[model samples]
Target chain A: MTSTSSPSRKALSKIACNRLQKELVEWQVSPPAGFKHKVTDNLQRWVVEVVGAPGTLYASETYQLQVDFPEHYPMEAPQVIFLHPAPLHPHIYSNGHICLDILYDSWSPAMTVSSVCISILSMLSSSTVKQRPADNDRYVKNCRNGRSPKETRWWFHDDKV
Target chain B: MAAEEQEVRMEVEAVQAVYGDDCEIIHDFPPHLHVHITPRTADDSSQQFVEAILGILCDAQYPQKPPHVHIVDSKGLDENREKHLITTIENKAKELSSCLMLVALCEEAVELLSDMNHPEGNCPFCLYPLLVEDQSGTFAPFMKLMSCYHCFHSECIIRWWKWLQNEIIDSKQCDSTISTSAGNQREMEQQQQQNCPVCRKLFDAKDIEHILDYAGTNSSQPTDVIVEMDGDERKFLECESENNRRQQFESLLKLQQENSGLIEPRKEIVVVPGMYLPTTVMPTLAAIDAADEQHLDSGSTAPEAVDLNIPSNKATTSKHRDMNTRRKNRNHSSRRQPNVYPNRTQWIKKEAVSSDP
Candidate 1:
């Protein structure tokens, strides 16, 4: 599961810390449906449990998402990955990396953790097939050194989930 | 008919008063009026973002039949918005059928215009409402692209534009490193296509540059691109602390003057002949002298004499006479440090005697 693996060594900046705190408060007030934030002391890393939507192929299945914020977070996208025993999904790699554009090049500062969570949940809920990506084994081997998903140049060829 | 004519005349006068120069009478006989209506919001007027010129045609039957309202011209408003505006006004006129409703109709038009004043829909970049709907009523100010009429929050568009510029600059930097013909071709392609973030419409840099000032002022985020680009965080922190240190020094000086009569009561301090000191430096000298006297009374001579010599060396550079005064100051500084002061005093005394001849 690479439980001890950290995404980046850089510490969160003051602005990133402040914004994350705000997001934490908002999340506590009204968390996204099908998601539960695991309470932890660390502000830089968040582990959330996602319950697959009722109608999806992975319905009722539970998956863990690990979100690690970069130093220039909000400006930079958080590295979001599924924990080991990842769901069988075409866009998600076996190494837990997800090929989502918003978590990479499409990221905007205005998007918060809550918004990202919703986008991921929606991506999961709309999947028509339960299968790993074609090159998942090769990609996972390449990322054996614990590479962040943000470093991946994602090719978002499919608009459909 | 005469009474009806008077009522129409009064209504026309009322509309003129309400709309001022916006209300223009094309023909007086049948009361053909043109009223230019814009939203009441200050941004709408400054941007000229939305406005409608309504032409009202009144038949001879007049008040009995509601006046015909049609949109003559408008900017930044689509056909649907224009129709909705005229329809709302026409409905108001129908309700006020038998009475002189010209002024009321114009007011209603203004009210509706204001309601629909803002640029519609979300910012393309963030997909958030540009004008937020909430109790706080805070919304990011939006600007319309002059060429395409596509609107976006000032901050969003600016950020995207800056990001594009940075991408180009970065590519240019990479080109030099690569120095390949293929890289040059890619750079040329990037230069040729700086499309609108939303529409992919070709827009010149000037289109966004014109509103750069507005974007800068309207930005709510603390971290601006300029600050990030400069990356002078250490320099900014140093300057801040430097200011704090200066302020602390000034306050300490002020406190010392207040406690001890360190400074002469301004008017009474006659300037010493041939001694030129800035007013601020004078207080510092007086404070040092006062501290020196206190040290002498306490009989701690060695350290006090050393401290006094340091100031004397700094305060007087050209004159041997100032040196004599400083030796006197040092003598007064501490009685216990007689060995150090006596030697300096003897040297100054000899100098004074030699200069007197």
Candidate 2:
């Protein structure tokens, strides 16, 4: 109904547009100054400034996350990863495969970008004490050896950590 | 809750069950007990069946019944390589008993012929048991075994002959008859040691006689054979089994697909790289509040003990400076802050590096 594309393709495209638009709206709710999204080719990066309490670990930090969409877009999950100056959280592997349930295997078509960002924010806020995963090296090796990120199962139970 | 929210929650629960606290690791069985040998060799051309199975399990089509295990054709394998594949599979079956779901997708033609010729449950080419099942209910008992190059059931082969005699032929439904019949005739000729119509193998008639003798000895009670004359009935049963498998696969795929999308969206929040936040953060705020209440109740640790006009100061100057500062900061930050995207480059880079070998 939307375009010359097949029904499946059109549905997928509409879903992608809706998701991206929802994300943009959420940003609009409290649009941050000195932060914005940039798209170059097929890559989209969200730039952010670290503005919180002084002495907070994240204070004085500037971070960016790269989001890439497959040709299938929403029918397939977008590939989002922390792009520059990667953080070494137990859940955030060195390979950029975030052990976030919502972003990977647990994503729903209905989840807005706002909810995802909120989850990530809370994840950061509550992450008080945790170490890098013990088998971090092995996990990286496995990914390099052609294991899909979605296939690898990770355990991230400690919110306080 | 909305349907999407409910679905998301379900996905979280599923992932938690599979890879969360109290997860049970199912190890694979050992190989010596496997039912069949690999007809194909362990060459580069060999299908990586295990990887393929895992891939299928993770695919969007997963939990549709488990992907049928394929036995690659053995025409390319040497005897030793073929034996190696069979043994490897057998060893895998034994090792992955608890961890994996195993199923045997036997060819009906091979099974029928083997049933007639070999009484023991062993493959003629490599005497491995073709029967197999997994504990997880991943595999069904019966298989849609393709018979010969015909792609029809052996029973169907017989049924077709019966229908042809009855003169109720439906050529449209069974369009594959002509070529299959020709192929069978040629194969029969080859078995007779006549110049094989197709392969020209020139098999010895003595071998054919010996095989027939073996079939005669091993053939089970032919009286138990039951043929459903109605193609509709046959189609119903096939459809039932196939649909059951397809449904399971679809559910699994749906589960995986839903789970994949359930991940938290990427955020530019500061990641505390190479550092563990103090565990005291959770209990510290609560303990501080409790400590303040106790001090007020006990009338100790208050400047009132030093008689520094502490009681009056509570009403006069607010001694909650730190609390006020914290509260003020929280209030300022909690309100819609400017839409600043936290730099996530370091986090993403770390992820990339860690994912690399």
**Native contacts, share recovered per candidate:** 0.00, 0.00
Tens digit of per-residue lDDT, candidate 1, span B140-167:
4566665455567665666555555455
Q: After superposition, how far is residue B195 of candidate 1 from its true place, in Å?
A: 7.4
A9-83: candidate 1 lDDT, tens digit per residue: 678866568778878887898999999999999999999999999988878999999998877566567888889
Chain B TM-score for each model? 0.42, 0.14
* True interface contacts retained by model 2: 0.00
Q: List RMSD in Å for every model shown.
A: 22.6, 38.6
TM-score for each model: 0.47, 0.28
Every candidate's DockQ is: 0.05, 0.01
10 residues in a row with least lDDT, candidate 2 chain B: B219-228
**In model 2, what lDDT does residue B51 have?**
11
In candidate 2, what are the lDDT values of residues B92-119, reduced to their tens digit? Answer: 4444443323332222222222223211
**Which candidate comes out best when scored by TM-score?**
1
C-alpha positional error of residue B127 in candidate 2 after TM-score superposition, expressed in Å: 62
